[model samples]
Target: MSDSLTLIEEMLGREARLFAASNVESDDRSHRTYIVADFEYQYHRSAHAGYQVAEGAAAEEKIRWPFHRIVAAAWTVLRFVPGQAVPEIEAPVVLTAETMDEKTMVTQFFDALAAMPQAIFATWGGEAKDLAALRRAAVEHDLCLPVQLLDLSPYSIRRLDLCNASSVMAASVHLPEYAAALAIPSKPSPRKEIGQLVENRQWDLVADQVAADVLTTCVIAIGHLKSMAVVTCDRPATIMALAEKAAETFPKSIFCSRSFRPWARDRLRAAGLRGTVFRAP
Candidate 1:
């Protein structure tokens, strides 16, 4: 194993020892783990594209993101002894407002989240509007919003911007610098002009671009951990296909593309995380 992997294993092993000591088990190790579910508003954009509801109505409605479902679903495939399961973690929720006035979308998310008794909602780029919306919605709705913040900025393995063309510009300028530091090739292309494309309202292209980001980001997020799940707002078909391919390539690694509802339950089962563990095996 690489030094990085070895160091990581040692850290996780230390934690596992503690975990096993606290539970009733022969070995102080568990297959269950936590992962950060990085939510992005994929369905929000889809609803706008399909005319299911006017953009105005969609903003007000508490619509679920499809990618959340995929994340939850993927959890069903993995199973292990449960004891405050340690293998799953999700990214902080990430949402982009289609319009400045649609801060209500953020509010709705937290309000719904607060309704859950025991919950962990992750976020990416959770500052500013995302955090603001969460606060406002949680307060106004009189809900208990339990959130553990996962900052994505510091640990960003790679970044893909789907909302606007600015991401292209940023990537073009930033990636080259990054590659040079790593002694890799630096290539620039006309597509680097993100501002212009966004101005043209190229929604499909935008989704495709962000989808690529979601895939890349999720892969990187899970790569470092011994066990993990990467929740995303990517379309189910796309996410599942990737996970399937990954499973084929890496038989030992478990990947799932499920929604939060079903997947969360699976997580509970696989991790044996229903309640607190008073003792370890």
Candidate 2:
């Protein structure tokens, strides 16, 4: 792997993903996948040049969704089985493609998700942004999309928007703020101008941003699971150890990758984790 790729892989996580930390009591609760995901897209600057968007109204209409091209996506999979302390967490696998070849990116993303048993797709505010972009991309590419991705109903069980779920659509709250409030470790002022980065084809930086965002959301999802009593831990150290145990099982290439030591040290921190190191048996 090139230096940039190595850096990204190290940041992304080991192998495919890690584990889900769920609270289902049903017989079918054997396995549930918490797929936290985020996508970055580039839009037609030629079409919207010099156009300022109105915040409250017409914002949706002003930013034409049809011109969107999904350039990159970060998929974080967390697989949790009842009675298991940690669900296999496939935190993030970054995918990148040219705007014209968006079909390939879209295809691989959903195809991989489809292959996962009992996947629940998630995003920050994907219902309005990511999902719509995907639907439009599918239309343009003539691809069959999963109904779960297309469904926007609040009653829909398969897709979840963490932003809406946690805040009830409070205008001031976003993923970063939510992470901060929860004491989730985040580098202050991470770059979020993903569209700009995507336009420049800076996929490495894009991956950096997207991957970290997915990680934050995954932790948040774990927080939700804890609140619902799906996952019971004596404290943050317990969660940390389980996550480390899961990471230790990953392939050697990723297992020995850089940044993992520090990455592991920081997680489930401030938000509820005490950073207790877990010793493997």
Best candidate, lDDT: 2
lDDT of 2 by residue, 1-281 (tens): 59899767644532223222112213355466667888777776665554444344534555576667777777867766566665665535777764436788888787776565257787887876788888887777876566455445854677778877777746736777777676564422254566677777876666566666666677677777678776554335434643454345433323212333345565445545356656332
lDDT for model 2, on a 0 to 1 scale? 0.62
lDDT of all predictions: 0.33, 0.62
**Please, what are the lDDT tens digits per residue for candidate 1 over residues 1-69?**
698997787567546543443352234234432222222232335544455445645454443332111
Predict model 1's lDDT versus the native. 0.33
